[model samples]
Each structure stands twice: as C-alpha cells, then as structure tokens.
Target: MENLERTLSTWIVRYRWWFLILMPLLILVLAKGLDLRFNGDYRVFFKKDNPQLQAFNRLEDTYTQTKNVIFLLVPEEGHVFRRETLVTVERLTELAWQIPYSLRVDSLSNFQHTEAEGDNIIIRNLVQDAPGLSDAQIARIRDIALAEPLLVGKSIPKDGAATIVNVTVQLPGIDETGEVTEVATAARALADEIRAHSHLSVHLSGMVMMNASFSEAALGDMDFLIRVSAGAMLVVLVFFLGSFGAFGTLLVIAMSALAGMGVGGYLGLPFTPPSASAPLIIMTMAIADSVHILATFYQELDSGAGAKCRREAMQESLRINLQPLFLTTLTTIIGFLSLNFSDVPPFGDLGNFVSVGVAISFLLSITFLPALMILLPARLPRFQFEIHMMTHLGNWVVRHRRRLLWSTASLMVLLTAFVPRNELNDVYVHYLDESFAFRQDTDLLDKYLGGLYYIDYSLDSGKTDGIHDPVFLHKIEVFANWLRQQPEVNHVNIITDTFKRLNRIMHENDPNQYRLPERRDLAAQYLLLYEMSLPYGLDLNNLINVNKSATRVTVGIQVLSTREVLALEERIHQWLSDHEPALVTEGSSPAIMFSHIGEQNIRSMLGAMTLALVLISLLLIGALQSLRIGLASMLPNLIPAGMAFGIWGILVGEVGLALSVVTSMTLGIVVDDTVHFLSKYLRARREQGMPSESAVRHAFSHVGMALVITSVVLISGFAILSLSAFYPNSGMGLMTAMILTLALLADFLFLPPLLMKIDKH
Candidate 1:
C-alpha cells in the first residue's frame, strides 16, 4: 500500500506543474453554477406519491385551493369597526381580486352578509359605503362581523382588532415561484402604499409568504452563508496549516463547492432551502483531505528533511493518510446517501449534493492537493508545537488510562440517557426564524389576528344531497362546536354555519331559529337561497360540491408544534369515532402534512440509520482486517452522536424533522476522525509489532494534529449551520457540529485509553 502511494506521489511531483494547471482548469470547467435552480415551496419537501400530499391534493380538488396571500390590517384603535379602517380595507379588498392568478378574495368589506327584509332576502357587502356609512351602520357591520362564522377569525378577528384580506391564487403549472413572487411583490407594494397613505400597519403573510421565505432563505444562504463558511474555514486553516498551506486548501475547497453545485445542476436537482447548506458542508469536508495531506507534508519537511524532501514528504503523507481519507469519504457518502431514505426531498437533495462534494474532495485531496503542494513550495516552517502537545496528550492518555476510559464512558452514557427528551415537533411557519420578514410578519399575525395554522376536514354524508339532512348538519355543527371549544382551535368554518345563518334569515331573522333546520327539505331550500345569492368566485363551490355529498370544513388553530398537532389529531379521531363514526375521514393540508412527516420521518430514518450502522461497521471491520479493533472502534464512532442528541435534549430540548437524519449525517463525518486515528494505531501494532504504549504514541505522532485540525475545520463548517435562517438546516448543522466536536474528544481522550487498557501496552 505504501509503495503504490509513494509511486503515485513521485509521479505527481514529476508532472506537478502540468497536473496543477490541468486539475484547476477541469475544476473551472465544472464551476459554472448559474444554471443551478432553487425551489422554495413547502410542498417540495413531500414526494408526489406521499399519502399526506395526495390527501391534501384531493382536499384541494374538492374545495378551492387554499394557497393564499393574506394582508393583515391592524387598526390603532384596536377595533376594525372604524370608518377609516373600513375604507383602507375596502381599497385593499378591491385590489386583491386583481392579483395575478387570484381565484377568490375574502375580506370584511366584501363578505356576502345575509339578512331578512320583510319577506325578502338581502345579501350584500357588509361595509360597502366605508366612510359614507353612518355610525349606526358601522356599529351594525361590527356586530354582524363578530357574529359571522366565515368572516370572524378568518378575515375579521373574533376579538375585532385586526382583519385580513385573504386572496386565494391558483398558479400556473410552471414557474410557481415566479407566480408567488409576482403576488408577493404586488402585495408588498400595495401594502406599502396603503401604510403610507392611510397610516395603518399592514402585514403580509400566508402560504405564499411561507413559500417565498424558503426561497429567500436558500438564496441568502447560497449568496452569503457559503462565503461566511469559506472565510471561517480560511481562518481555521491558517491557524493549523499556516498561510501558504491555507491558501492552497481554500482554493481546493472553492473548487469542490463549485464543482459539487455544478454537478447538482447537471443532475437537474434544484437546491431547496434545506439543500442549500450543501456548499458550506462541502467546503468543510473539502478541507479535511487537504489538511491531513498538507499538515503531514509540512511535518516531514520540518523534521530536517529540507527542500529536497518535498517529493518524499508528499509520498509519505499520501501513503499514510490514503486509507483513512478514502474510508472517511466513503462513509460520509454512505451517510449522506441515507438521506435518500428521508420522507422530505430536500434532505435527499442535501444528502446527494454533499455526498458528491465529499467524493470530489477526496479525488482532489489525493491528486490536485498533492500536486499543488509539490508545484507550490510552502517555504514556512513546520508547526512543531502542535506535534509536541499531541505527544504529551498521547503520554497523558497512557498514564491516566483507567480514569480516562471509565470517566468518558460513564459520562457519555449519562448524556445518552437524555436522548428521549427531544420530541418530534415541526412547525413549518417557524422553519424560518425572525431573521426573515416572513417569520416576523407571521408572528405578528398570530399575535394579533389569531390566524395561520389550519386543518382541512372533508366530511362525507354518504348519499346524494345527504349534506342537507338535518342529522348531517347537526353532526357537523357539533363537531365544529367541539373544535371551537378547544384552546388550540381558534375558528371552525363549516357549511352548516352558513346553513344555520340562511335558515335564521328565512325565518324572519329570529335568533331562536339560528339552528340547524328541522327537516332536510328546509335545510336544502336555505342552501339554495344562499347559493343563488352568491357572486361568481365567491360561490358555495368552495364549501359544497355539485353533488352535495361531501362538505369541506376548515379549522383554524394557533401555531402549534407537530407533537401538539398530532395530539390534537388523535383527539379529533377519538371524538369523531364516539360522536359521528362515519365522519372519521382524515384531514389534510400543508400543516397536517408536515405534522405527520415529523413523526413518520423519525420512523423511516431509524431503519436507514441502522442499515448505515451495519454497513459502515462491516466496511470498517473489513478495511482494518481485524474484528476486535474494528468492533472496538465502534464505541468512538457512535458515541459522539448519541452523546450529542442527549446534550441537545438538554440544550434545545426539542427537535423537529431534523432529528431523524442527524444520526446518519454525522455518523459518516464523525467516523472520519476515528478512522484516521485508529487506522494509524492498527498499522503500527500489526505491521511494526509495537507495544501498546509505543503504538499509541506512533498513531498520535502520525495523525493526531491532522485529526484535531480537520475536526476543528469540520466543526467550524457545520457551526455555520447554527446561523442558518432555516430551522432544519440550523438544527442539522448545530447537531453535526456538536457531534464532530464530541467525536474529537472521544477520539482524543477516550479511545487511546481504551486501547491501552485492552492491549496492556
């Protein structure tokens, strides 16, 4: 193995100039990233065949599409009844209908209010006259709005301080982001105009804003996060590799990121927000290969080998580090490949992108890096202090083997116990933090208007026109009333509410008659009257289908985590089973889909991570050619992630969809340091027949500084993830960085002591 590596390095040195120029030109050819696309829609997280997505689509097909652009208007007086507020709302309401791809617009000024007028049914806008409305008229409008089922808590809050202009848009098949941007751009301009002209604070939010947030955060990461990560990495490299080595390392990482992203573009996979972390992740991994090679080369040169020893140093460095690098890269690729097992496509994309980056990094590390080192002489002296400190660390591990082994093992076990504390809870709206306008605006809406979270329930009556049956309406009314009573549920919109209103209107506007009609015929006639009075696009089609067999109900709730949502869903099922057995159909929506996936992803990742564990273990065992040493290596490789989750359970206390995949993601990466450390120790023991203490010393003497430097570089790279605006990327990054740091500790403080105790060197 050493002879082959020596030959390759010597050959690379012979043609160093040609290879260096050629490799970079090849990298440059692959560095064009403008062709890469990005998708920000929340739906991109789910696959086409995902049951929750299909159910949501079916629900959309039955009712109007729920994707909307909402403009929340907050009046200073804490009441939406004022004439000036109504005027602003009226103006916005009129403009909302004209938004590109808008299918319907609902607001307080355009609510199809119903009342009785001496044997005549009156249906008209609640606040059409705006400033011209008399005080008595405005008072009546407020009263009716507060009492209205569809308007209250949807357009006008039941508490009456804020109102929303809800515009439902049906976008074209292609360029969905373009359509969302158009609506958002127009809405923002319009809101700014309204705010400046009327002195009212208008906040824009909704499905569109959330979708746009994904794209905005991803683009921001690509534009800024990658650069920040590179700058941080250059600092780390300089601290470890010094100026000349750091420059070459940074250039290789830049090429790797560009080439990896370019490969993604070639594969036709767009970078969603979650996947946008790939460039930063790739940059970090790219440094690992370069650091080990260059650091070792510098050591060989500084050990009195001198300028003439460049080829020999490169040869020895490559010969020693090749197996570990290859193994680490392979495991990382496998770990990332496990992302394909995820329910979310973005994670899959992320896994593929980073996997490719890791692969390219390995190739460059072996070829381009060594060639660059030979071509560009790093005239700086070797960093002898790091080597001396690592020798002391090795000696200390042997001296305190018993205490180090027992203490670290016990502490890790204690940390692992906290892993169960984190629950699977995802809130899609909070996926982007306050660093984004969407989050700030969403928080404002949730605080003031009590909007956002929703669940769509499709209730089937089992027979044609059965929706008009008094029994069905009564059951729906009971269910809606039950939901409204729950603290989490703010509003429930049922066709039955409209039916009850129309029935009351038909019966001389008597409050006593504001209940489900006694007969099916009466309920059917009231619906007929209401449907006849509705205008185009504001018709009952959104609520009831043409067959009148099934009705769509929308339940509005506060922003709750998936754990809370799952609990609520279970309660719903229990209530439906006890009260109305046939109404036990499943609910669907973007919120529901994400809520369900947070649980499902954990289950799916369990299998994939286990598979990865087995496969990687086999690879390690085979690579080292020893059952005992390879099996022993598992403790160091696996303990860090387990310990990290336990600590995360303490620090963060809760995780979302990211928890399921973090194990595998960090497994491949964290194992690299262990492989580098262990492979060197095993090589020393098996080949040289060194005593346990000498073998441990030899291992540290070979790769200790590389292990620490690369881990620091990797840690810095992933630590950048903690700064992400997107929650999943942030969580994954923080978790990975924590595990990588812990892996360094485990490898440094724990593994060596265990080796000494086991081998009795």
Candidate 2:
C-alpha cells in the first residue's frame, strides 16, 4: 500500500498540470448539478412513511390544511377596541386576503358575529365600518368578541389587549419556497403600512411564517456561514502554511464543499436547515484531508529544499498519510450513512450528502491537493514553532502519563454521571433563535393569548350524518367540557358551541335554551338551517367531513416538552377510551408530528449508532491487524461520545431531534485521531520492534502535529456554526466540536498510558 501510494504521488507530480486542470474542471461540472432549492415546511423533517407524518397528512386531507400566517395587533393605547386600533385591524384583515395562496382570513372584524334581534337571527361582522365605532358600539363588539369560543385566545385574547389576524393558506405543494416568500413580502408590507398609519405594533407569526423562517435561515446561513467559515479557515491555514500554500489547499476544500452540495442538487434533494448546513460541514471535513497531507509533506520537505529532497518528502508524506486518511474517511462515511436509519428525511439527506463529501475530500486529498502542491510555484513556510510546540506537548504527556490518564479518566466518569440528566424536548417554535421575526412575535403572542400549540382531533361516528345524532353531540360536548378543565389546555373549539347558540336563538333568545337538543331530529333541523344561512367559505365544512360522520376538535395548548406532549396525547386517548370509545382519534397537527418525531428518531438512531460502533470497531481491528489494540481502541472510540453526552447533559440538559444523531456524527469524526494515532503506534511496535514507550513516542512524533492542526481547524469550523439562527444546526455543530475535542484529549493523554500498561515488557 505504501509503495503504491508513493508511486501514485510521484506520478501525479510528474503530470501535475493535467491533474490540476481535470480535478477542478470536474468539480465545476459536478457543482453545476446541484439544484440548490430550500424547503421551509416543517414536514420536511419527517419521511413520508413516518407514522406521525402519515397521521398529519391524513388529517390534512380529511379537513382543511392548517398552514397559516398570523398577525398579532397590539394598540399603543392598550386596547384593540379603540377606534384607531379597530380601523387598523379592519385594514390588515382586508389586506391579508391579498397574501399569496391565502384560503381563509380570520380576524375580530370578520369573525361572523352572531346575535339575536327580536324574533330574527342576525349574522354580521363583529366590528364593521371600523371608522364609525362609538364607545357604546365598541363595548358591544368587545362583549361579543370576548364571548365567542372561536375568537378568544385565537384571533383575540380574553383581555382584549391584543388581536390576531390569521390568514390560512392552501399550498399546491410546488414551489412552496416562492409561495412563502410572496406571502411574507405581502404580510410584512401590510404590517409596516399599518404600523406607520396606526400607533399599534403588528407582530407576525404562524405556520407559514415558521416555514419561511426555515427557508430564509437556510439561505442566510449558506450565504453568511459558508463565507465566514471559508475566511476563517483560510486565516488558520495561512498561519500554518504560507499564503500560496493556504490558497492552494483552500481551493481544494472549497471545491470539495461545492461538490457535496452539488450532489444534493444533482439528486434533487430538499435543503432543510439540517441539510442546508452541508456546505459548511463539508468544508470543515474537507480541510482536514488537505491539511494532513500538506503539513506532513512540509515536515519532510523542510529537511532539504532541493528537487530530489522535495520528491522524497512528497513520496514519504503520501505513503504515510494514505492509509490513515482512507480509514478516517471511511469511518466518517459509515457514521453519516448510519443516519439512513433516521425516521427524518432531512437527516437522511444530510447523512448522504456528507458521506459523499467525505469521500470526495479523500479523493481530492490524495490527487488534487498533492498535484497542486507540486505544480504551484510556492515556497514552504517555516512552521518549526508549531512543530516544536507539538513536540513539547507530546513529551510533557509522556512524562506525566500516569497522572494525566487517571485524572482524565476520573473527569470522564464524573461527566458521564450527567448523561441521564438531559430530557428530550423539542418545541418547533424554538428551533429558530429570537433573532427571527417569527420567534419574537410568537413569544409575545404566547404571553398575551395563551398558547399556539394545537392538537387537531376528529372524533369519528361510524356512519354518515352521525354527527347529528344526539348521542354524538352530547359526547363531543362532554369531551370539550372535560378538555376545558385541563390545566394545559388553553382553548377548545368544538361544534357544540354553535349548536347550543343556535338552539337559544331559535327559542326567542332565551338563555335556558342554550343547551344541546335532546333529540337527533331537532339537532339535525337546527344544523340544516344554520348551514343554509352561512356564507360560502365560512361554513362548518372546514371542521367536518362531507358525510358528517366525523367532526374536528381543535385543542390549543402552550408549548411543552416532548415527554409532556406525549403524555398529554396519551391522557386524551385514555379519556375517550374510558367514555365514548367510538369517538377516539389519533391526534394530528404540526406540533404533534414534531413532538413524536424526536422520540422516534432517538429510538431509530439507537440501532444505527450501535451498528456504526460495531462496524468501526471491526475496521480498527482489521486495519491495525491487532486484536488486542483494536479491542482497546473501542474504549477511546466509545468513551468520547459518552463523555460528550454526559457533559452536554450537564450543560444543556435537553436533547432534540438534531442532537439524537450526535453519537453517529461524532462517532466518525472522533475516530480520525484514534486511527491516526493507533495505526502509527502499532506500526512502530510491530514493524520496527520498538518498546511500548518508544512506540508511543514514534506515533506522536509521526502524526501528533497533524492531529493538533486538524483538530484546531475542525474545532474552529464547528464553533462558527453556533452563530446560526437555527438552533438545531447550532447545537449539532457546537456539540460535535466538543466531542471531537474530547476525542483528541483521550487519544493523546489516555491512549498512550493504557497502551504502555497493556504492552509492558
């Protein structure tokens, strides 16, 4: 293997021009294949086959789609009923209909306010002709709005300080990014116009705005993070290598990143926030490959500057680096590929793209990087200061190996104790940082109007038109009343409110008649008359099926942790089973889907992570050709991840869908230092017949500098991700960096002493 790699490196140097031109040209061509589109829909997180997604889709197909953009209006005078605030609400309500893909617009002014006038039933807007609202009329509107079940805590809070305009959208499921942008543009323009005219503040939020946050954040990070990372890497590389060398290596890395994103585009993959970080991640991984090769080559080349010495240095670096590079890349690929086991599509896509990128980095490291270094007219930079520092660090570790090992081991155990402290929690709204408009606005709305999390359920009756059955009506009313009593439930919307209201209106506006009809015939007659009176799009069809066999019940609740949410769903299911078992339904909504996905992803990733660990362990055993060494390698390989999670448990204490894949991600990255160190150590022990102590020194001397350089580069790259507005990417990036850093420490401080103790003479 060494001879073949040396020969290949020499041959590439011989025909360096062709190699340089071809590699870059191929990168450009592959890069063109990337489609580069973003998907803002939260559904992008789940695969089609995911049970939670399937349930949500089924519900959407049955009833109306719940996608919407909400505008929360707060008057400067602290009253939505004021003449100016009422006018602003009316104007925004009218303008909201202009948003693209808008299906229905709901606000206090358009709430279909119903009341009794003598023997007649009057149906009209709650606050029409907004400019003419007298104090008495305003009081009446507030009274009606506060009493309506469908409006309170929905379009208007009970205190009447803030009102919301909900614009429900119906997407065609094509070019959704563009549709979201259009709606956002129109919504923002409307908000600004209203804010300028009226003294009130208009904050925007909702499902549609949430989706736009995903899309915009992806593009924003791609634009800002990629550039930030590139510049940062270049600066780090320039200090390690000279300007010319840094430029050449960065070119290889940039091409590698482009190639990875191109693969996603070529495959027509959707870029969610998780997948959108591909370019930055690929760049980080790719730099290690080039840096290892260049730093090693420089070490040998520095001994002599003549052409003959240059050839030998290049040859030696190539021979020495090939196996370790290939092994590390393969492990990384395996780790990322394990994400295929995830129930989420974005994760799977992320795994696939990164695997491709790691492979490309290995290829470029061996071919393009070497050829560029050989052909580009550049002088070697003096890095003896760095090499000397690494040497001192290695000698220091060897001198106090015993103390270092015990201390680190003890620290790791202490950290491990915190692993169980972390609880799984995911609130989709929190996925974005407060910098985003949606997150900020949503927080204000939650503070004023209860909560936005909703559980959409359809209680089924087994037969068509069975919703008219007195038994079904009474059961639904009972369920709603029971829901209202729950502390977590903020508001409950059921058809019983309208049914009771209509009953009272029919009996000369008598308050005692505000109850469900005792017979099915009377209930059916009242429903028929009410349906006939309502306008086209404002009917109950949005909440019921065409056959009327089932009716949708929406329960609004505040955001809760994954465990709390799952427990709530289970309790609701149990309640229906204990009483009215036939009315049970699987809860379905965006919030419900995300809540279940985190748990499913964690369970699914357990098998994938175990398989990844096994396969990597086997690879170490086979590649190192030492059962004892390979088996021991498992400790460092396994402990770093455990220690990282333990540390994370103490520091963060909340793992979400993104963090679930941390084991698999860090599994591969952490193994790079291990493979480099162990493979070099074993070679010294077996091939050179060195003592265990000497072999450890040889391993450090050979690859220690490269490890430090790569770790620094890798750590810096990941730390930059913490700047992302998207928390998943931020958490994943920061945590991976932490694990990788710990791996370096374990390999350096722990592995050597353990090896000495085992292989003692």
> Candidate 1 on 133-228: residue-level lDDT in tens?
999999898888887878877777668988888888898859988877887888788888899988578888999878877888888877788878
- How many steric clashes between backbone atoms does each model show? 0, 2
Q: Which residue segments of model 1 deviate by more than 4 Å?
A: 15-18, 32-34
- Highest-lDDT candidate: 1
- The residue pairs that clash in candidate 1, if any, are none
Error of 1 at 552 (Å): 0.6
- Candidate 2 similarity to native, TM-score: 0.97
RMSD of each: 1.7, 1.7
The C-alpha TM-scores of every prediction are 0.97, 0.97
**Across residues 201-266, which tens digit of lDDT does each residue of candidate 2 receive?**
889988888888888888899899988998999888898778877987788788888888897789
